[model samples]
Target: MADATKNPIADLSESEQLELSKFIESEQQKVKLQQAIHQFTSTCWPKCIGNIGNKLDKSEEQCLQNCVERFLDCNFHIIKSLESTRK
Candidate 1:
């Protein structure tokens, strides 16, 4: 991927360049995380809640909460398991 940090504005001041690079990297990471969350939400919402007509009902909301919680739990467990297996 092209480094956006190489532009003239970023190359102007040393501190500004570093700060801009960090900001760009952080924003890219944020976008990636947002995309992942959106994908998970899209898949999980349908699995947890059947059909959607209007605003999310209480039951559907509960299901979404459960989906998020379970997804995090699964991610945590997977990371822990990987660490152990790497030993």
Candidate 2:
């Protein structure tokens, strides 16, 4: 039987490892962004939409825009507060 605990990434050179790490981190950020967008849409959809319309009326469009803005503002405020606490 062969040992199964080895990591293949450990075989790469230092530069290669760093590059792979950065690439992985970039991909993770993209995934997180996508999840946040989905969550934003999910939360705001039912709140602003009452029926399946051909297109969004002006009020519905405004509501969605406001919802997204508020969501972003809340997240930014929380992040800033956390950073201040860490300092």
Candidate 3:
């Protein structure tokens, strides 16, 4: 586990950097998105694709789109509420 205040990725050493490069190349073969987007997509994908199936249904596809929207909405609501309370 990493410290909450510090970035763990920034602490990688020379050998660790080389290893990370290899790992990232392997991951890139499967994913087009960057690290953060990949993480978000992976988390949201499971939420949207809870069960193994031949393919995603229309509802599951909608869930993937809605998941991103809902996350943005929640962030906006929290910011607005906090601003209102501070006033």
**TM-score per candidate, in order?**
0.72, 0.82, 0.43
Kindly list the per-residue Cα lDDT of model 1 for residues 1-87, writing each as its tens digit. Answer: 887668678446888888888999999999989997997788687777777677888888888888888888898899999999999
Overall local distance difference test of candidate 1: 0.84
lDDT for each candidate structure: 0.84, 0.93, 0.82
The sequence of per-residue lDDT tens digits that candidate 2 reaches over residues 1-87 is 756998888889999999999999999999999999998999898899888789999999999999999999999999999999999
Candidate 3, residues 1-87: lDDT per residue as tens digits? 656999676789989988999999989865754664675587678788878789988999899889877776886899999999999
Off by over 4 Å in 3: 1-39, 50-57
Q: Where does candidate 2 have its weakest 10-residue lDDT segment?
A: 1-10
Q: Write down the RMSD of all candidates, one decimal each.
A: 4.8, 1.7, 10.4
Kindly give the stretch of ten consecutive residues in candidate 3 with the minimal lDDT sum.
30-39
lDDT of 2: 0.93
**Per the 3 Å backbone cut-off, how many clashing residue pairs does candidate 3 have?**
0
Candidate 3 colliding pairs: none
Those runs of model 1 whose alpha carbons end farther than 4 Å from true positions after fitting are: 1-10
